[model samples]
Target chain A: DAGITQSPRHKVTETGTPVTLRCHQTENHRYMYWYRQDPGHGLRLIHYSYGVKDTDKGEVSDGYSVSRSKTEDFLLTLESATSSQTSVYFCAIRDSGRGGELFFGEGSRLTVL
Target chain B: GQQVMQIPQYQHVQEGEDFTTYCNSSTTLSNIQWYKQRPGGHPVFLIQLVKSGEVKKQKRLTFQFGEAKKNSSLHITATQTTDVGTYFCAGGPTGAQKLVFGQGTRLTINP
Candidate 1:
């Protein structure tokens, strides 16, 4: 296990509400990524951070935003939740020393009603 | 945009049977990585193939990268209940910083 932790392991919120999921890591990795997993879609990248205050949008960035102010914390926010946004979100840290292998956290299951 | 496609959305096999999944990328990949996710669990790294036409094996599991660097495959021998899960292939495009994942192939084993 790679010292990664995701807050709010499970959440259920009504549509149109704002939600933020947090990912914290202790490995001091340089790369952190956020991914959402859905049936038939595998794991789709949402956003990623290469360093403090350095972030990039992923393929599925619509309706979602992210921030990383510190090396150990990454945050993903859903501006306005929707039913389509319901999925399991995973936070990962890239271990460049290990051929850039990604070690993921336990994951956060979010439900939008 | 780079895309990775996987075949057989779902597969069911009896214990001791063989199973295989294929992965194809729309663009040539600098590297291909495989991950396995058990039901209700997060994806875990399995292996990565960086060289073209590379083949690697892990016990009863075998992994291969195409000569063109645009495809890969994972083959499991003597499937067991422990192998039931979804297998995903992610492709890192040449000079790209992000990896694109395939839809994945879900495996179910009947003991």
Candidate 2:
């Protein structure tokens, strides 16, 4: 219960369409991360933001981009949806004081047809 | 890239039985953390172990960090039906805040 929220809990889009998922937090955390969970891959980071307008690519950044214009909001966008991109996406905020433990949102399940 | 591997991808146990899952990392870790995700729910932070050969317990759940700092284990004593879900171990490398998570072990409890 870290006061994190993810919009569009579920989505289904056609291939080649653009989709954006939003993550909003009220805890005023300094670090925000986007991750995707698949059957065998587990949770793979796509992007992370350390501060407003400061972001970095993660292990699985291909075909995905992120932006954080404010401390409370982080956005992840899929430029062109692909079948391989069909997975559950999670938004997390790092608890700097707690051994770098992350608090995750409810998650968004996206399906590409 | 650092990789954290978990064994026994799937586990089935009867209520009151004991269960354990292991996680291994290819590189040394500065700290390790455990998370649990209930069925159709998000991952929730459980505990963190920083020092080598550290052991911590939360009721029936016991978490341990290996002496080498590259392995970790989560053991549940007298498993309950509520323990049905996936358990993940994430490792934070030395001098970095980023964490690499293990694939996770999905536990199914037979009521």
Candidate 3:
């Protein structure tokens, strides 16, 4: 295990509301990623951080923002939730020790009403 | 942008049957990795293939990478009830930082 934890295991928010999900890791891994999983879409990356204060957008970055002020914490925020944003979000840390393997946190299931 | 496509969006097999899923990419990849997500669970790393025409096996699961590095496959033998879930193949392009994942193949095993 990577000792990763995601806050708010489940959430139900109305469309147009703001929501933020937190990913905290205790392993001190250098790469952290945020992904959303939906039926038929697999897991799509939303954002990722390579180091403190260094972040980049991923394939499905629309309507999502991420921040990493510390090596152990990465946050993903939806400025305004949408019905289409309802999905299970996952946070993962690349295990360089094993070379290219990612250990994922327990996912966060978000529902937009 | 890179795209990884997986086939047979869904599959159902008897407990003792064999099952396989394929993943293809239009562009060549540097390395390919496979992940499995059990129902209601997060994706977990299963294996990573770095060299072309490479084949690796774990217990009852076998993973292979194409000669051109543009495709991959996972085959499971004597499937069991625990095999029910979705299998995803992901790859990163040369010098790319993020991985693109295939749509995945959902497997259902019947008793």
Weakest 10 consecutive residues, lDDT, candidate 1 chain A? A94-103
After superposition, candidate 3 runs with Cα above 4 Å error:
none
Residue A51 of model 1: what lDDT?
Answer: 90
Which is the better candidate, 2 or 3, if ranked by TM-score? 2
- Candidate 1 lDDT over residue span A84-110, tens digit each: 999999999986666888899999999
lDDT of 2 by residue, B7-105 (tens): 889999999999999999999999999999999999999999999999999999999999999999999999999899999999978877678999999
Docking class of 3: high
Q: State the fraction of real interface contacts model 2 keeps.
A: 0.84
For candidate 1 chain B, the 10 contiguous residues with the lowest summed lDDT are B91-100
- Candidate 1 segments exceeding 4 Å error: none
Evaluated at residue B82, the lDDT of candidate 2 is 88
lDDT of 1 at B50: 98
lDDT of 3 by residue, A1-113 (tens): 77999999999999999999999999999899999998888889999998899999998999999999999999999999999999999999985556777889999999999
- DockQ values per model: 0.87, 0.89, 0.87
TM-score, model 3, chain B versus true chain B: 0.98
Query: lDDT for every model?
Result: 0.94, 0.94, 0.93
Enumerate the chain B TM-scores of all models. Answer: 0.98, 0.98, 0.98
Tell me the lDDT of model 3 at B6: 96
